[model samples]
Target: MSQKSLEEQIQQLDEQLSSSVEHQEREAKFAVEANERFARNIACFEKYYPQIATAISEYKVREDFCIHVTTTGVGNFVPKNHHAPIYGDDPISQVSAQVEYGIQHPTFSATDYTASPILEDDKRIHIRYMGALTKAFQEIQAEQKERLTVLPEHFPSAMIFGIGLGYHIDLLLEKTSFDYCFLIEPDFEVFFASLFCTDWFSIIEKVDERGGSLFFQLGADEQTFIQDLETLADDIGAFSVVRSFCYQHTPLPEIIELIQQWSSQYFRFQYGHGFFNDAITGLAHTVHLVEKNTPVLTLPKQKRVDLSTPIFIVGNGPSLDEAEEFIRENADKAIIFAAGTAIASLSKKGIDCDFHILVERPYYNYKVFGDFLPPEEYKKTNLIGLNTLYPDTTDRYKWSGVAGKGNEAGTFLLEVVSQTLNNKGIPLMPYCNPVVANTALSFAMFSGFKNIYLFGIDNGNLPTGEHHSKDSIYRNNLDDENEEGLVCMGMNGKYLPANFGGQVESNDLFMGAHFQLEKLIAHYPNRTVYNIGNGAKLKGAHPVRAEELLPLPEANRDINEQVEFLKSDFFEQFNLEEFDDTLLGVKAFNEICDHVLGLAKEPVSSVKEASDNLLRQARYVYAIRNTALHHLHHMIKGALLYYHCPMLSLLYTYTDEQFTLESYAKVNTLWQGYIIEMKEYYQHNYRTKCDHGKD
Candidate 1:
């Protein structure tokens, strides 16, 4: 057929779809038939289990959800350990129940990796028919029985596995427990078939809140599954696979090795060196790969013991000067967790650190404290940052102090410190912004500290004229003597000195800061983060102005009036530390540069292996890039949809081929404000001044 004719015919067909009376009648008939068929199916199911008809009728399933054949038995049946296996009560409601559930909230869209063009049309690949799967399941079941021995005698109290349809799960439940299962399937056609399984099945859904998407997604291709496995492995602590999902792609031996490494690392992440640390000798090399270019976390770490211990997270706010005496007096009673920049000031005051965290994100001065210290002190302080942040830090602190992502380290510290001491460090952040306050407070919670007292949290700007603006506290060229003192690094009229932004309101945005602080203070009941001077704004007395917002003495203030705050940083902090239980993680993180710079040296991979590996790693990269794109597809689209972001403007116009994962992460972080803005529309909690392509 001619190209023009082909195009015209397609267009005609599209018109016919919209215009034909016959089509409308057919659609109406189809709808009617579908409703009838569904009614009959429900009737049939009720008939099969008339005794529990009420329970069956009460079974609730979300509307407009597609059911995946894989997740059919999730909620319908209960596992052994669960007590009251209500559908989707929480992820692993009670591990002891025999019933399990699967529920997902998919926000970003995802798809499978591309495969051979020939495979696209293969009837066998579509999985529409189950004869093959039936046979495959039969064989796998026997194998599963053998593998079952490897599993503990007690299966999880309740188990939730994703079933593409009910076939695999239906058969499995027949062999096991059913009264406690709850299924979640994303495909409607598949869901209906499974729901017909008597009173044994309850179906839920995975909805994508970002309008057209779901919070979780399945891999589209073999490559997608591999990538998904890696992501799943990251959180499992120790695991070889995501419980129910299957990967059809046959990975190379090396890729399998990577999987093994992932399993090992996850083991370390959970069981620690007891399982895989010494089994793999290149721990130092792995640590090196992960340490580079990460951000400094403003995370707070405190020991747990006694009923209460005060903590102070010193920020470089001018108020640090006034609070000095109080910190000096109570420094020993509470741990002083210094923000990277304030460590110098705290150190100069002879305040020792029981816990020190560095949220060294590159965008901020991640290495602000790195260069300031002499070589020996490397072992003295604990270095931390967001795992996302550390990808960019230089390899300076290896084997000396622990270098874990703030998110991960924070969770560990919370657990560890909570058991060790009674007193905790008080959070003393300087930024007036709510995000900063929230971040700092979240870190405190994770570090085992409760009952935090707020200090140096001048959420507003520095006093009328005595702010960091006047002198130069934030100069990039800060020396050892300077971390505690100010060194000017300001633009002539950019900040302080009244010329900044040419508006008094700009300088007065501290009110906005206070507004945010107030909101932040409302969230945590266990915390106390109030402005001591009743948020007094200082007049022009610079030095004298510093006294307006220092720490408040507990002996004098009304206990109830102390402001408290809370926020969830779980996704970042917990996810990071969870990886440390495995030495595999350390090996996985090591790079050649890492081994060369610090710690125990390791041999490089063979040149041939490197080349061949890069080829597959390239594939992994493609999967990562595509997955990220899928996750942020809405945001990327919005970047262009709204012309407000210049970076997105440049990014959107770049060649499509150039949009690799490495490039995407960098560019996205570089111009994050626009991206963050787009993400906020999806995740209401996402807020960042510059991350969302604000400019």
Candidate 2:
């Protein structure tokens, strides 16, 4: 009886063994197919995005992370640091349902849809028209909340926060497409695992077929994710990213933090749009300066003078009042350069700057300078500024030099002129922006100054709300009552860590300057920058109180001779006659105008179509690379983004197709008119209307 029972048990055991063997065979087959797909995906990335391809190729897989195949033949990831699977039992159904629900009940409110209106008192034709257009669109947006109930069929941009097994991406693409898709995976291991499970090759192909861009932020952590995204938005068009459908695949802590950072910093892309009139004015001023034989401030060929002579970059902040005695006592010890209206403050304190730097391009800046300081005060001070500085203002200084401002039409023109006359072009100043102190610091860095000292560059306000020094032109213009909260409101209207340990109120402009100063300071690792003021805390700068400031030895070198040597080493004078033929010809200008006009005039049936049209327009302008009209692209790109972003926002926000199309039509008509006006201005008036200075 026992022998028969044993035979039966052996038969059952053999059947079970056979079943196990088959399961192993099936799993091996799955692994082979997954590897094949991963190879194909890597090949696709190599063709399109080599960076991601290289990262995946170089990735070292974690020992504990394994791809677990479920009973239903779906892959799930188990991370080394995690206790459980990234996806539960049924990843397919779970992701499918998530995608379906996400599509039907989408979350679009994550972005700041508020449009930044052009509020500057600019008289340029484009600025005025865009301002009016912005106001009109804002009125339209005011009605969006009541009507925006459904999500649009398509979007210009899509951001995938996490890629667990990458199933949601496939599901998303199956439903709709995006002009630009940014896929962010903070953990390289997760992304690498997804390569085996998901058909990324097909995804890249589908996106490519639809004329879309796919950006991979593989291995990007929370700290750098937002900055990388911002940089991508900048390289592409910021307007194209007006509305993006954010799909969060996994709710990891890192992913959540990245989303929060993005939500907070997205507004940065909306600001700093260069409008048309400013472009024209900058061009005119630059051309006039070049024609007048004004020297262009350039990078030094070699470190001719000892940079140890501590150069002080002075700003007209309230901290200047406290540091006046220290600065005055050490005036001869260090070369002082006054930033913007700081000259007036320094003059009031009977301090003379070696160089007075101004950045604003308008004629009013020149007029204001004259009003603040008499010619006698700055007679010994050298004038250093952007190429767009008013030509008449340069005439009042002892000597003058200019540098090319980044992303300016005037800068491009100067580059062209330089290229035509000489084989080389000027390099734009790095981190020069939003404030005069930035330009001063950039100049100091560019000139190879090793020991740079920042005084009174209070990129914030005192607790009492005094932003500028009492003797500053701002305070002189205002009575005591009007002196409070004197600074212009910035993006982050809050307090920041101050140099001396207390908080100081800051705004967008000051915050931008603070960030730029930190970046510049970090950029020159060889230089030591000391901040001696109650300003916002700079990351890479050493902070010292005025009382603690160690006395620097008086420069052994002849200061005047050093200044002359710098002028000779880093300044160039170009022949104005050489630039006559270098200006963008009428044909090329008209061609660009026509391209924009064509995009504006294109018929759009849906919000998606209109969004694509605007994207195409932005891409077209930005794509005018290495041409004379390339600078024109920079000038127009910002205004285009400023106008197009809000327009697209309205089109997407309004659910009704008819209303959306109607709004698009009205905006398109206005855009057409603007382009026509711009074309006319460039064709008929550009050469003759240098009335700001040349005429």
Candidate 3:
């Protein structure tokens, strides 16, 4: 009522007006920028090169880093171009429809196939399919070879998640060099088929061609994915990415345990029942985007290109002896890329590598590289490996992140290599064997060169038997090698390791190294490839003998205009920083939501639909509200391993831990609410179906 009080109210009103106006202005500006970036992102993938875009979405991106950069959609939650296989039925099937690729729980029944699998081991039909697979594998290599240069200048490797036959797989293997290959084939029938149809030798050679590796993929079903995880727990600490897909029908608690275990095991975990984000996140960050192409990272008036000497790749298959003459004659003319073990032999035989693509991942067998290297030459030679040891391995073992002590070595190896190369190896294409074909072809695409020459990349089952003749390690895993491990050569030696100790093959480098390589090459396809090894078969059963082909001179390939453009403006202009603000906002949003925890909670908007998609991130957020994630993982698993109504358990299953601190009671409350509702609905639905059947 006093004059002073009246003035105070007026002052407060004025402040509110200013703040509101400022906030609105900021919001409007943000909206415009967001739309622009989204448009650019789309254009980068669609107009410039659509396949590159799709491949990057699946092969090059990494979720933890790329999620913050941008979202698929801008105006609303829905995106304009839905990238990938989305399951939608006319009447809306919810999780039922989207779970097409889903693996069933171990105890679950299989869908009735009108035609059951033929148990008769018909040698004739099997041999014919084997012939077809072999031929298809070779031709695929040729096609990928011709298509390598089609990519824009960003990604450096290539990765194909699953095999639908050996078409895409063999294409990458024989064609070029990828940093690493990640292959995941969970089907038993296909696993056996690969044993005969696949020429895994070429995959090993291709991995050797580039400084990369190869690994396997496995998905978690309720029973098996977990059991397998535990079985492979000690060995799985070195994966690049642990990926899975599950639907609502899957036991929710089991899924949580699987994710937690994977994360703690020094692996990057990715999952999607039917979401594009899961795949894209892994591919985007794995890419090594260059300044010559992306406006996002481009600088003004960048020095375009400089013609450099042609580099020759030297592999260690039996085909090595075949290329001896050609390499010896042109020894002084070009750069030689020696595969892992081939280094020692070739270097001794007066065929020294100018740039060694050191792809070996094991501790014992990989040491052979040191024997070959002149220590002075080691510093000068381009020592390429997966992001396992660059800038050195000191940082990974110092208890970084949430990973346990068991995962220290694997994590360090990856961190070291990821930070190793500047941008020279920006675009590398892989020439993997049948085992790692996709990864090899992916690398060939990214290495910035238009022409890739592959030697000793013999994809045929090694002539001396299953093992590569050049390798002394007995390195590759012969059985699971075709299935769960895209994993390249393992550590071989007499010395036992200190931890579990003894001659155990390291599985850590399989997923992490190779997956990164595939993503790189998938985006950069200009540097296409051709296999010159005797066993580097393409187009038919017979290998393409490099001895028969005419060789090209080195001087002609030196002055490529593209390379110059890449080097000049790529560093200063291309600003990864521009996307940092956007990334921060995304991280904040995720922190509040909890990534994996959301899947375990009740959805407000649509329960059935949300359950089908089953978000993992939200569930992670929910879990963070309480006991350590490591401990809660086991607790949650024990409580919900079997099918108990989640809603019922949350309401009264009663964990002894304090529910108040972590909102456990609230979760229980909502979980029980869903169950009671579901019980009533099930009765109604049962009656309705019965009535319909009677009619």
Candidate 4:
């Protein structure tokens, strides 16, 4: 062999060895950096969100999921069982360009305001004026739509749909600051791969420093994603999500489903915005009832009742006519509950219920008993209702008991007062809202009835548009010219999945009640719930045909004795004099009013400033969440959103600096006036009424 050829061959071998060493060094450095990143992220999650921390700590890496480092030194995620990288050769530049494009064209731009003005003929000062103000601002927003070309530098809230390698999250955060950030990653493996590449610790620290929130919905699929979001919105102020800018990092099918679900049900946040009148009236009624020594429903502390007797929860739906025979035959064999206007239907059928439930707080509810049914019909039946129920309505019954309603200022105040006096507060009835059947179901559940059957509680109208029983007041109102027509504007164009395998027309109120019932049923997993008629298919309830009802053994126990036992088991009377000061909640109420008033009057220089001021108010309200006046947040949140959201839309849509400033000032002024009016009205009317009751 020639000496020159041998030397060349030797040189090539040495170069190969050097290249291998370089590759090993790079791999080692990458491993170290990944370990450091994982540790930091886990630590941050543990501090801020222990649930996420535990999930991440326990999650095992999928066999196919891995981090692929490109030649450009950027990490890309190779999703489950996929060989190809999620990002291209130059992932940094790819994600950078994508985020920049997303910034320019947000997937879900925050322009539309969800809160509709309450059109109820409420004569309260705030309700009357705020409704008019909201309508005016809504008009302004409609006019300024074309000008909403760019998002403000400081966005109020954001929803990041996916986190692939988390590059876009870093880029998005660097470009924009959000008060509330909801990061959702449907794939756990993808998120786990991201922990090695993304500096989540830094991101969390940055958000924390800004006094912002970061909600991580890890491993959430399309099925439960919106419900998760709803739970978060309930925990935080729902108003924060009113106009959130949504960014979809990875266009997955599940993410698309989530987006659609969110769009369809976003209006739910706008519902149940207890205005000042309702809040004050609820408080007054609650206070008056407690003072009258009305029996309150306490949570059951004993084991679940294993009675053979079934609970028949009756409602005035269209199916009532079909279930009449079933209810009549079973009435004597079960403890029957007549929900709301169902008493009229039951009276017509000559089937007396063991208990009659009422939920409405207004005088209209009190008039229902006097106007529709005579004293002989419901006088023998026991009354179970929310604390917000009209006091006079309970007077018609032989016996009555009230349970605390969730998400009401009156309930919160009563709870605090109860806690102050007895060291234990009242138990809030779960999902008792939007309808009377919900209250009846809640009562049945709390009473520990194992076998609860729903009759005529159809949460949707039939295909023929028959909503109520023939004997119901709803049908009676159609004939009586003096009775007002049904004001169901909210339910006019809605539909729901029917129990018997078809879609049925439903309203917002019924839909809400249906969902609430599902949630309540879920809380009692051991209990058996049967929906014995065609209705909106509830998630946790078993649908049964009226004719195919479960045949139970004849009830051996005396029905009257069982009814009295239930009353004694769940009901107690509170001494109002013991906690009169706490019951008023004047201090906390005034504090919240002061904070909101200041926020409304705060000066605004830019759209960002105006938005931030509104968010600041939300933070203030939510920060006092552990206090007795927390429900005040619920009371005012909807009304405040109705006022602020339209104003925000106008500000975001219109680029004219002077015009935006002027518009914000005008709206803010009107909002401030409303808050002031609310404070004064509550003090003069509700507070005075409570004080008088004490005297």
**Count of backbone clashes for each model?**
123, 3, 107, 0
Evaluate residue 55 in candidate 4 and report its C-alpha lDDT on the 0 to 100 scale: 84
Worst 10 residues of 3 by lDDT: 398-407
Estimated TM-score for each candidate: 0.32, 0.90, 0.34, 0.90
Which regions of candidate 2 are displaced past 4 Å?
A: 1-26, 62-65, 109-122, 142-145, 476-492, 500-502, 687-695
Better of 1 and 4 by lDDT: 4
TM-score of 3: 0.34
Q: Which structure is stronger by TM-score: 3 or 4?
A: 4
The true-versus-predicted C-alpha distance at residue 169 of model 1, in Å, is 45
lDDT of 3 at 498: 15
Choose 2 or 3, whichever is better by lDDT: 2
For candidate 1, lDDT tens digit of each residue in 1-695?
89999999999998887766554564555446445555654664464445334444665554633321112222233322334322343222232232221211111111111111222222321121122323323332333221211211111112222333233443333333211122323223334434433222222111111111111222122223323433433332111111222111122343344334333322121211111111111122223332321222223342223224555666545555656667676655554556555656566666654434444332235344555556555455444333223322334443112223221222233233223332332232322222233345445544445545444444333434333321223543444564554463332232222212222222223433333343334434455433332123322112222244345344332211211111112111222322233422222222311321221111223322222222232223224223312222211222221121221112222223133222333332322333233223322211111121112
lDDT of 2 by residue, 634-688 (tens): 6566667767877776677766778778877877787888888888887665433
Pick by lDDT: which candidate is best? 2
Q: Which ten residues in a row have the lowest lDDT in candidate 2?
A: 686-695
lDDT of each: 0.32, 0.77, 0.34, 0.75
Cα-based RMSD of the predictions, in order? 22.9, 3.7, 27.1, 4.2
Better of 1 and 3 by TM-score: 3
Off by over 4 Å in 3: 1-310, 339-342, 358-374, 384-389, 393-444, 463-466, 469-528, 534-543, 554-695
Question: What is the RMSD, in Å, between candidate 1 and the native fold over all Cα?
Answer: 22.9
Extract clashing residue pairs from model 4.
none
